[model samples]
Target chain A: MDNFEQFFTENRLKLDVEPLPEGFNNQMIANFRAVRRKKQTIRLFAAAGFLLLLVPGIMLLQPFFKPEPVALQESPSSAELSILTRLQPYQTEIESSTQFISQQRVPTEYSVQFQDFLIQLQIIDRQQDIYQKQIDSYGYTEDMIQQIMYNYELKLMVLQKLQTEILKINKLSKTTNHEYTNIQLEI
Target chain B: MLGNRQDAEDVLQDAMIQAYTNLKSLKSVESFGPWMKRIVINQCLHFIRGRLNFADLQLVNTPGESDETDYYQFSMEELNSTIQQLPDGCRIVFNLYLLENYSHKEVAEMLGISESTSKSQYQRARQLLQHQLKKKMNHG
Candidate 1:
């Protein structure tokens, strides 16, 4: 124990360290102050982001301010139904279609086919209006008459042609469900 | 050997500034001293990198002026030079264990090394420093 104490004493005595010059503490204080300033900046940015998240709710009803869920509730209609609330997907498709049509420098045969498909769809819509009017006028008694007058065979043929043209247009757009899947796979 | 006190002060100040700026990214605040020391050491090493050779170490032979001289005690200059002479890993372990008084387990956690490795490095540093002191005494 004495030997150990002597060794410790010698070690302590031999330990050499110079005092930092005067104002060293001041430098450290300055550094700590700078650190505080940086922390404040980060806090400010985080506060800004947090406030920005509240912007959408500023005009909303007070009920929306309820606390977030603590535990997960099992439900089948969790997220997918959100697509139906806003016409987001359809609006996006319309915007993309308009952009594609407007941005093309050269008009191609595909554009003509697309225009024809639209015209054909308009015609079918008109025919459906006429059929609806006839059905209403005849009441329940003229079912056979209404069916014969509309010519179901010709109408079916036109409907099948419309379906085929719509499929062609979907293919030309390069934006079908299959293409969406492929793009998702690539991503 | 870094010219003068002003230059050392400048380097040390810059190193402190860098450590302060990057303090948030430092996961462990308990080991802040060694972390700051590391930055300062690196700056000092960089300042004297290419200029150092075996002959430069010979200047460390400044003899004790008296038997009871404080020069035998831990002079910052001598301590700094002794630390500078240590290998990178050994120097870090030495400072952590000696000045900071960190246990091998704590040093291991701080350095992301095994506890045994920290213990072994600490032992190696002690042995190496003893060897260096013996050599200095014999030469002097």
Candidate 2:
């Protein structure tokens, strides 16, 4: 070792490091506990504050989402009123045809198809109502009102054609059964 | 070498608190002693740097009275007292290099100074400590 290194080594050998202050370890552990407790308290407060904000936030948003009951007898827009008036003449005829078709004895295989067509009519009626409401509330263009009228006329034509086909099938089945009874009498 | 025992104890305590708080970040548990020692050294340096400005370190003159021959005859207590009297920068370098057994390169890195500066500061501290010890020995 060099002179300075040797000298430092000798000095280090002779040097005495004082023992840590009495009860230092216990004091440190106590300090650590206090610090930990403080941190946990801070975290608890933060969680409490978050929950306080969250509960009121959810409550405040509930009313905006609660479904309101829509009132009946609200006057339709003038365009929709005119369209309904134009369709008034066909209303009785369409209703009678629908009742007759419902009363007819359809084949079990055709029952599901007939029910599906009725459902389609109901869906179209609902869609037309929604479009009418949109036009009234949003000041939709005349072209939009015309489109709704055209769609309603098309649905009426489809129902009329379905009623005619069902009536023809019923008449054919009645004739076929009557002819079969006559042949049995002859045999 | 941190001026007094009270200051040294305070730094040690603060370093311990810091070490405990950040213990989870330590990668090697076996190096805990050296890691804590580094923290203590850093705290001591921070205290010294706060007490004495960088300009003051440059202004401190190297003691001219003593040579290496004077250090061998002194008692450990005398040597310690003499070390404490060194200027802040020199004493820090001396303590880190001699007592802490850090290399000059490590001392330079720790102090954020050039290696040559660490070397010169250490030499100055040794010379001043020897000079102070010589005076005490002659008087006693």
Candidate 3:
């Protein structure tokens, strides 16, 4: 036999090569079962951890689905009152303008000039009121109200200038020989 | 010998655990030692990958610790332990050829090594054993 073969056989003889210890097979089987059990335990823990991660997500979605009742606290302040007061003038102007247009064009679905001016004015007033209330009812300070009012006033001035320009055009067209070529009244 | 025996033992224990853990995926029952050996080797490599500078690894000899004991005089247990003491690659080749009766080609295929490598390892193992046997005879 080759030296490797001889040595290997000799070494093989030296080895007890017994089938493990008495009950060793049973022990190994038990160990294998324990290892499997451990893996299962780890998997269970992983699943539980994943479920735990979803808890906040589920809570966030619950608010979107069946929302909890939010109690609105009433705490209207001077800023809110001032905002309503500022909007009152624009609201009166629109109402008066619409009334005038309704009287002038009795049975019209909508007087375009009146509707345009009133809607624009109302939108500006609504924006100002929203800011005012955010400051007052939301416990915003006087300084914040002044800041929002300043912005709203600048916007109102620009709209008023635009309205005046429209009025000038209307007057010049009526007095002069030139008629408004594009003034197609659907009503 | 490379590190603390406790550390090596721990690594071996871990490798055994890993082997058992992944036992279900193991298709062949007979390939358990090789699988365990792979894990042990990987663990060892991981422990000393960049840290160990293997300059003379090719020249390094398999452990020939003692020059005692004739072949037949040694008990089966002694022989098995000595075989186990062989370097990782040589021990594997020895087991496959001697105990399992695997051909060199089969061993090479199984280990993903060249046929020449398997043959050479087997030859080296034979020479080492012959030397040990001769020493034992001279001493007696």
- Identify the leading candidate in terms of lDDT: 2
Model 1, position A33: C-alpha lDDT score: 67
Q: Candidate 2 chain B: minimum summed lDDT over ten consecutive residues — where? A: B57-66
Q: If ranked by lDDT, best first, what sequence of candidates would result?
A: 2, 3, 1
A87: Cα error in model 2, Å:
34
Model 2 lDDT, residue A56, Cα: 99
User: What's the count of clashing pairs in each model shown?
Assistant: 3, 0, 10
Candidate 2's DockQ: 0.25
What interface RMSD does every candidate have?
A: 7.4, 3.8, 6.0
Could you tell me the interface RMSD of model 1? 7.4
Tens-digit lDDT track of model 2 for A1-187: 6666677876674654554577655575566567778898999999999999999998999767543322223644665566557656566666676676566565443444456567767877788788768655554445665666676676777677767766665566576644322111000
Give Cα-based local distance difference scores for all models.
0.53, 0.68, 0.57
Candidate 2 at A5: error in angstroms? 2.8
What is candidate 3's lDDT per residue for B1-140, written digit by digit as tens? 12345767777787777778678866664565566556765565455444544321223344544433336666565455555555556655656667666788986776556777777776566555556556555776
Clashing pairs in 3: A3-B126, A4-B126, A13-B76, A14-B75, A14-B76, A14-B77, A14-B79, A15-B76, A15-B77, A15-B80
Candidate 2 steric clashes: 0
Candidate 3 per-residue lDDT, tens place, A81-150, comes to 6556865675566555444433332112223544565566567667777765754444445555465656
DockQ of 1: 0.06
Weakest lDDT window of 10 consecutive positions for candidate 3 chain A: A102-111
TM-score, every prediction:
0.33, 0.47, 0.40
